[model samples]
Target: MDMTTQHITLGAINMEAENPVELAAFWGTVTSAVPSVGGGTVYLPPAGPGGFAMFFRPMAGPRLERQAAHLDLTVPWGSRQAEVDRLLSLGATYKWDVLDEVPHVQWTTLADPEGNLFCVAEHPPAS
Candidate 1:
């Protein structure tokens, strides 16, 4: 087998949610992804090649443990704060903010409706 062909590529990140519809809607709105449902699963298609599709599975109960992994979203320069605010208004709960944690680094940590932690960071616009 060719070494390049054997390399793995991420397809999607499956998340457990008490309500797949709501969770899928949230992610769909954030990413502007097209949402689809079938076989009792909800999916949000990837925004681009670098992005991965999100799959939401219905869970029997509320999330009982902290998430060991989380999503990090980066916005264009000068848009991080506004994006955070918009997410908050869209049902994300604020966790904490770190400003100037390191030179030119600023971010805010937040949890989704299901208490899954994710971060929003600012990055320089693509040249």
Candidate 2:
């Protein structure tokens, strides 16, 4: 099966938010994306040609349930703590410690301002 034969290409990953502008700005900073708005929704340009990007749309509802999918962010090798500190200062909340709960993993679970969960870890150094 030739996967390229499938015409479907991922355009973006979108998240439902109460405030699309705010969430989009947060995600833009997180991913270093160039953010733009269209039809009241936010779009972030991909890092490169044909790369998958991000979007955020407004949603009105009660409290959101835990999502099965979450983001795993990486920092430069050995900078996990510093990155976590920076994100925390930028309005991210500490959720849980992976090493404390899982015993070996060196990741920390965190939540964005809107309570969307994500993880931050150190990227392995280049060989």
Question: Residue 118, candidate 1: how far off, in angstroms?
Answer: 0.6
Looking at model 2, residue 93 earns an lDDT score of: 96
Error of 2 at 80 (Å): 0.6
Q: Considering summed lDDT, which 10 consecutive residues are worst modelled in model 2?
A: 97-106
Clash counts for all predictions: 0, 0
- Which numbered prediction scores highest in TM-score against the true structure? 1
List candidate 1 segments past 4 Å from native: 1-7, 60-62, 124-127
Return the number of clashes found in candidate 1: 0
> Which candidate comes out best when scored by lDDT?
1
Candidate 2 residues 23-93, lDDT tens each?
Answer: 88887777667789888799887867645688888885765576889887766667888888888988899
Model 2, 79: alpha-carbon shift in Å?
Answer: 0.8
lDDT of 1 by residue, 18-37 (tens): 88888889888888888798
